[model samples]
Target chain A: MIGRMAAAFAAGLMLATPVLAADPPAEIKIGTLYASSGRYASISMPVHSALKLWVEQKNAEGGVYVKAFDKKVPIKLVAYDDQSNTATASTLYNQLITQDKVDLLVADSGSVLTAPAVAIARDHKMFLFDQTGTGASFFSKDNPYIALMADPVSTIWPKPVADFLTHDGPALGIKKIALLYSTNEFTGTQANAVRKFIKESGAPVEIVYDQGVPTETTNYTVIINNIRAKKPDAVIHLGYAPNDIAFLRNVNEVGVKFKWMFSIYAGLETELLEKNVGVKGLQYVYTYVPPSELDYPVNFGMKMPEFRALWNKTFPDGKVEFGFNAVAGYTTALVIEKTLSVATSLDQMELRRAVFSLSGQLKTLDGTFALDETGGQIGELTPLGQLVPNEHGHLKFVAVYPHEVATGKPVYPRP
Target chain B: MPSAIRHLLFIVVPLLVVFAILPGVYENHLMLFNFVVFLILAQGVNVIYGFTGYLPFGYVGFFGSGAYGFAMMVMHAHASAPVAVIAAGLAGMLIGLLLTPLLRLSGAYFAIANLASSLAVLHFVANPALEDITRGPYGVSLTATFNPEAAYWAALVVLALTLGVVVYLKNSRFGLALQAVREDPVSAGMAGVNVVRMRVAAWLASALIAGLAGGVYAWYVSVFFPDNVFSGTFSIFAIVFALFGGVATIIGPIVGVLILYGVYNLIGFTTPQYFQLIYGLLIMGLVLFLPAGLVSLVTRRGRHVP
Candidate 1:
């Protein structure tokens, strides 16, 4: 009886041992909200599905190994459908962090949706890894809890376009660039950033027409006609895939012409553009993404390529874009994995510290990166990608910007 | 048990359950306050749609006014929530009093008028002339939690007081007069019942409840904007509870509100997006089957319909 009592006491001590007393946590719970069932579902849902697949692949390899924990721990992703409603999105997201007790948080798809989530995360001192949301204010607003997984839209994106415009303008016999963007906070911020970047780059950017249109407006013939009438050196419009697809179809149909032209958003969507307009139509377009950072040792990071391969094998008929959306989801999982491996159990404060300390290379598909103190990237940079048609007709990941990541030379007067 | 003890037991049963799980159910005082706001609003909506004969479709309109009134006063005008609540009530009373003419009309007209009032308020809020004052659509933030416990306690007090008043009115002369107006205005008028007066009073009282609830809700939610404030769904939810509980009884809306709140939360835990669909279907079913509502079945045999 004495021996049994002693054994029972020993077992109880082991069971009751606090996570902090032992190795760091082996698993972390990430709460990510997205437009899973609403207007933004087409893009956001794919990111989520891709993310889930990445997590499964990681756990399959015995989870992430953190130096802090010195063990391989798995990852759990908790996603909520924002339904494209901001209020519902805000309330539900708050509940996740405060009530459901999630380890870390990931941003919802849109900027409007992410703003409140980011604010709440900052207030509570949680690491909010913002992936899909690209609004400039996210970076502008002083907060340490949030990071720009998708490089700040207003910060870096406009710079390259402006640089290319300035460098190639006089050389390529092009002069004027027209800026068009939506009225939303993210697009507006980008539009403003582009304008600022153009002036800094010594490019003559005459915004021929700056009109805000409603989200539900279907007919873009008039808008395109208005732009065509401007007849600038190039036309750069920023919007979602649906809006871009509609505008491009109409622009193509009307044979509206421009030189070295680019668009803001839809360039990243491979499937939507191909199904609607072929890759030939999308050739020469450039969009921003985390410099498809060359892969390193992290086993899960290596699995991204295989994940894409499996996706290709599973749905050969489908074509997906190689933009930052896929990277966003993958990055979130990476951050979660890192957090989990660093700790023995998912505790908010410990996970928060781990996220803050992420300064060196992160093995995300986007690239090796680190979130700075302000939750912004320290040295991580976004490189521009050109839509080069693969032999299979899908676009290749050909980085053509920042000179260093350039695979192919610029097609200056891209059609 | 004494009569009071029996009634007290009914309340205690749930109180004990909530007390047992309060720690797990709520993360902090802020969330508890949020629940309090919803509870108060549900009860107020119950009073207007459940107790009164009027179909006040613009329940949220009054609520919006109260929220903005408080938000505007405290954050912008540098006043407090307590003062803001009173100010919001006064504003609600003024609006309700102004709407006295519409109460002369019955059923659909009352609904249309109330709807028109809310939409008009919404449009006015969007007007650029007032944009500078109302902060347009960006909404005014409450800065911080701003006395969360106080807000929660206030909500509790309001709920208890409203329940008592509604019950007292249901059993008293004013309630009878209001019921007479609802049952048959012409007959009520012939029986020396000041039908219009009772209705107007009820309408004003209902608006008062909405106003107070809205003001409190603003402090709890911490952000007050026109679009969020004047949403028509508030009225729909109010109607759901009123019908669910047995609209005429003081207790009906409260019971219905609790059941639906539970239903909503239950569904919301897993999939929040489809909770509204469930709500819509449930309300439709209740209206179709139990015209008198679930609250009408005070007797055991009445529940045996199967």
Candidate 2:
């Protein structure tokens, strides 16, 4: 009996030897930066929360499955506050790469903060999924490790409006155009793209006046005076939410009405604009990005209704509003999940290869993921919308341009 | 112990040793780098405010100017990092000289005017019309000169020079004359002190310190925007740190940075609003109780702390 017991123990020890030889990591580490308390806090904090929620939800469902490890690995997320400063973002990113040893890296917000991370990601050969950093400079041939998860390249943000101008200008008797854009990277890039596009279009449309305004310019009186002097039939304002709202309020106060007033970011900030400028003030103000009410398909795991439900549940009493930032965050998580499923191994280099491998084949809640070698979005097109009163007597963004995505017909020659 | 020996042992040597060696032991080099920056800036504030009684509300202007100066040299001149850092110092002195006219306005007027000057500089750098040179609001990238270790040591060297100046001011008669000017410019002038000249010198020295700190900071971070370097938080933090530790002393700013910046890292990043609340309460308590700063606890009993 003693001899038999000894033999059985030896056999058990042999079985456990292979198991103890290599210890698998407790969880797959996902590291990211968040602008928790600075200028970008409102926009970036939600992205971090959404990413966290995705990880928690995945962990509940037995975590991500890695073929290389041949096991389900739970995600351990390490996030740092960047204080909405690029210097802080770069430092924290370096920490994430070196100290945290994160398996996957993600960017927080727009290109200003994301550009440094893009450079670092390329240098380290780390896979970076940029959530909303759509600056065209972020995806050069030199910096190819990063993939913009959502939002089209900022350069082409004005393309839909350009298309609208080229197609509808002659019929609407809108030929003269005035261009005003904020000096910010996103706005400036869009303004330049629009200028190039219009110059090359050879349409009857003529740009009367073009100028770039500082992002912090609260009073648009001087620019409004210039625009009134030019008397352009169509005025295009490309800027962020604050710039858009401020310009709208300033133009309204100055009584500088245009036949066609197109502004970016204002239409998406429906609640804030309505409260600040009133519902009637935003009527006929056109923008590029689609609003939440649009019947955007559930290409990723969550649809619009489900996303709204999750958003309301997570942030009740309108503490956090649902908008493009939240959608981009959610879509980024879905994309990462799909990428993980397709990746050959858990290695960072292999994961980058996997992102490129599944580029055109995948689609998210936003739209089809068509990224080129440098990770710039080549196929994503923003739907143009005009603000009009809906059945509820509230101003809602109705997709007007591009017949394929138009929820309602656009009203031209503002009242 | 002699004051010079005390400063060398307590202030200078410890900072050099710790900042140099800590990067090896502590893998968080970025955090350490920031700590060094705040230390230099706080001391720079002490030089202007604690020694001369002139509060520089726009100290970050010099710092931001230095950062841009460094970037411009690299981008336009293709100058080496060390050469660019020297130019950055000169740039700060130039800004200081330009703002000397504002010194005629005393107290709150000077503070407000100084603040406006900083904002003006920020707008100038961030303007799109100057995008050809300053890169405008798009910011500057110096990845080529981004050697963190080299920058870290260079920062230590700057800190050493800053502390050396402070130590001299504490021990030498020039510092006593500056204190006299702070107490009464008319009396200092009657006592054969060149009040205007002394004040200008101190102002330029303060600017030089901040400018050098900003230059090293840009090199360390490698990528930043106008808002990043010209943030009002730098001025606020430097002033608060100097005041909290009881300035006019070498050990004060050093101690303030260690305790407060340590607390900041502990709680400031995760939930900043809460940290801001706590810090606000602490500042109120400090003003009410320890008006002379934290070092008063040691100095109140007729004891000199280093």
Candidate 3:
């Protein structure tokens, strides 16, 4: 009887004692929005695929280390399609916050969709990693929870374009400027930035005509006639791909002459522009080159060659070639991983502080990952590129501005 | 029980009950809010297309106008949500009145004209030339009146009112006259029906319902670009739901929404292309086999649908 009692007591004690958790969490749940369908799908789908690829690569390499848990945890992405609609994006964001209980919130695409999420993230006190949203309004001292990880603000995008015109316009006898921009936020911001810079810089430039056209403007004939009447020395367009393509085709058909021509989003599609406009047609057409096109040395585990190789392997035949959008997505994932390494806890506040502390300390494939107090990217700068003919008689984007990054000289006055 | 009372008990009450009780039973407020929106929109479509035989291709015009109406009221007039919603309904009615002239045209022409008008409105609202007033393409954010709970309940109230209207249409002599006008305007005129007035009234009422739904939607989500509210998908879904279930009946749209929207939420977001393909096939099948809608399957032997 005594022996049995002792054995029973020992078993009860063993059962009552708690067992320590041995390994780190199997995965960290990261939630993001996606425009899997609708208008923005063509641009957003590739970025999302690249994001998945980055996460898969990290998991393959034994997962990412979390300083908070002092352990390695693989990432698990919980994504919802917003259908490229702002309301849907807002609704999905609420779900991500209240139901999914995501550890982090990353934006899908565009300022229009992501802007509403800023309020949601602030309300929930969740750390938001903004990807493609480049609205200057997104950054403010009032909301510190949001951080811009990819794409420079649109306000600064036109600065380089303006700088080129300011320095080279007079020398090339370019006196008058005609600026037309889409009415959407992205193009509107660029237009405003250009105006502000020109007005402040006092670059001896006369703005002959400036107007904002509807984003869905299919016919540019009337506008083109008005612009043709203006007889400007230079013409600059700030718009999306479709708008740019339509305007370019119209200009080509109308035979509008300009000493200089620059468009914001045209360079993103080098191959398409080459195919549509041809090498001769593209002469003197200027655009800003995305970081992915630059032959920069490897930084933060990514180089242009290696990134392209991986992209080809992963997508195989994706309609989207590796460019700004893909590189931005990959860089965003790297920034998230870097933040996780420094975070002391999974708590949103701690994570946000860690991200904020990464201001000038981190470097990624894009450039130095430095952010201002309001979460505006202060370090990364895009290089300007102009379409020039190669030996093969094909149009290729050649870095042409800001002498240091210039791969070829600017060929002014289409010859 | 009378057919009207039967519908109220079996269809209307149950739907209202489900929507009202859903927030507590299920924590997905966004999903529930969307249900209220579609319910109101589907019933709105039934009012015009089902009864008056006018296909409203740009039905989302009223919705977008209402959303902007509510936002402008709150932003400029500092009006309360209730007041804004009233303005929203008025906005839709006003736009409907402006578009009443298009009713003179018949069939595809009217549809094309209506679509063009809606697109024109979208461009006008989104134009930076009007930025000072409408905020242009930058979108509107009603952070001041951001209350999902209130918006959800308001949406339910709108649904209830819409259902009441559907019930009235299902049972009233005026509705019968509208149907007569839809079948043969000359015959309805000969039968002493005020065909023009009745059609206009139904058109305005349809616009009002969608407008109110839009107001509540804006209130619920609290932020939207012009594209968000003016999307053609709303018109397509509402028409499909009404057509799929059976127009002219109270239960059809409700049933259509519950089944089709349920499927939409299940797989639509995850794999939209596949879901779209499936949805297209189903719509085609419905048109070919079930011409009278899903309700016809039950009411095929000369039985009344609701």
Candidate 4:
């Protein structure tokens, strides 16, 4: 009886070996747990599509060489939706790591959703590259496995906006300013960062207003009335798409004017501006970004067309409007390509080490940023960008910061 | 000994030993602790529905508010968890007492009222008017409960006590009275049952259990952001387990939890989530054909088999 049981046990152990020994695929496939569904679907679906496009483009040109395999291996990304819910995102991230055993992971939008996924990545000894969803605190926190490709919310156009303030516009002597931000995680991060920047400068700060309002409340008349009453030097509003449009409409309709009106993220997403804010509404809203505006660096103004053309030809129909978000989305795939290129071996540890090393020296379309230990990108970039009228009567980039980058001098007092 | 008691000892005792050794389970299995917390919560819902026949579609509100209330107090005041548990229970009781007036009404109005209660609380907590106190949209985390095992043990203890309460209620005159009301309100009233009083008590008991579970969960997860804590998922767990596990049978919930958790673990439970559709299909089938639940179907079959 004992001999028979031992024989059965040995058989059971032998049977499990096949499943365990089923080595992961030769190609480095990253099963993505991004938001391809839910409200965030609009943002992530395009991002996954754009990422796949970049991968195809890279492969067609030349494959990424893996040092481990001593050969080039094509990368594959399998995408899924989190429904923009943290629990679901957490659950999906685990599946990607344990079952699918994705070579690498990409984070979905929103810090609230990404936090748990980051913990899971750390546990599984996998690299998670966060792009597009900017939350400054993620960079502020310490983690090894997670790397930052996503521009931190605090740095969402931080350099251009701040450069405009510190070097360019400060000399103009527009003293007091009013600060307004869409009440959300993204805008809150920018609002806090900007306030910190202003506070340290001691630039005769105005008491106009620095407040946040809900996404609802269609009528900004009451709040605008309050802001108009304060009558400070400039009016700054931080928001994304709809709020950006509604804020501009309410303030402009009420005839609220300032020397400068600044905005954050969504103000810079060109499509969001046209389809939502339109040209007339967002005429003078300024946005801030690091000197390296696009994900791929354009040291000179000349690079914009090639970048635009390549991006447009790739997604052609996407040209009605595009901004840093798409660029950041595209950059995530670029990071994977570069990571695979540097890894001397297919071993997970070697791949991770190569990524960490390769990422530190990356010069992206948006300019160069050093990848730090916690996986956040750090670039010595001048923060500046402003919104101006495009020929189509919509808002377009009018650099108004860092004196050097300013396309033209500041347009003060509204028009 | 009764065969049922023998069955309980055979099954429950071993399960107890396994749960006792659960802290040593792989780190990946930590999410199972979430269901232990969920079981306690579902039991609370069971009291309101199974024992008293009150369909509450909005218990998530009570659970969330109780959690946030207890967690914030502990964070701000540096209170102990044991103390916070009681405080959370009291907070839920207060909400139940406040909502008792709605119980005087009948029909779909009760369902609407319960759902409305959750929405009202959600709006109040989410709005900026209470921003200073609740921190508005930004939720407070329970940083104090960093020890993983402590959280698991705490959740387990609370669950045991809640089950004890359910067992006690089952053997009492109150349980008989509650069933009497559930069967026929007019008959219960004619027989001198204080239906309103009994319903109110059940609501209070349910709220207390919900509150205790919420506090435990908040501490266990170490973070209880408002939107996530107050989500409809909380209420759905209560409704799903009860309906799926043969409502009114106390042991039915344990079986429901086992099957549901197994499915969750298989697909939706893992990182790359895919089982949400399967979950919906399973629940839909249960609702459409097996209205009485899998347990009831087996029992009904057994009665006819002879």
Task: State model 3's lDDT.
Answer: 0.82
In model 3, what is chain B's TM-score?
A: 0.97
Residue A266's lDDT within candidate 3 is 66
| Candidate 1 chain B superposition, TM-score | 0.85
Q: Which ten residues in a row are the worst by lDDT in model 4 chain A?
A: A294-303
- Please state the i-RMS of candidate 3: 2.9
How would the docking of model 2 be graded? acceptable
After the best TM-score superposition of candidate 2, give how far the Cα of residue A274 lies from its true spot, in angstroms.
2.6
Q: Best to worst by lDDT, what's the order?
A: 3, 2, 4, 1
A66-118 per-residue lDDT for model 4 (tens digits): 65555666766666666656555655676677656777788775555665555
TM-score: model 1 vs. ground truth: 0.71
C-alpha RMSD between model 2 and the true structure: 4.7
lDDT of 2 by residue, A73-142 (tens): 8888888877786656776787788788898999878877786686567656788899888776566675
Report DockQ per prediction, comma-separated.
0.13, 0.29, 0.35, 0.14
Q: Write the per-residue lDDT of candidate 1 for residues A89-178, one digit (tens) a residue.
A: 656677788777776688776565665566566556776777666654455334556676645445455676666667655676667666
Counted clashes in each candidate structure? 8, 0, 0, 39
RMSD of 4: 8.5
> What is the Å distance of residue B175 in model 4 from its true position?
3.4
Off by over 4 Å in 3: A1-23, A80-100, A115-125, A136-145, A218-222, A295-299, A372-374, A396-409, B1-6, B269-273
Error of 3 at A89 (Å): 4.6
TM-score of chain A by itself in each prediction: 0.81, 0.91, 0.91, 0.82
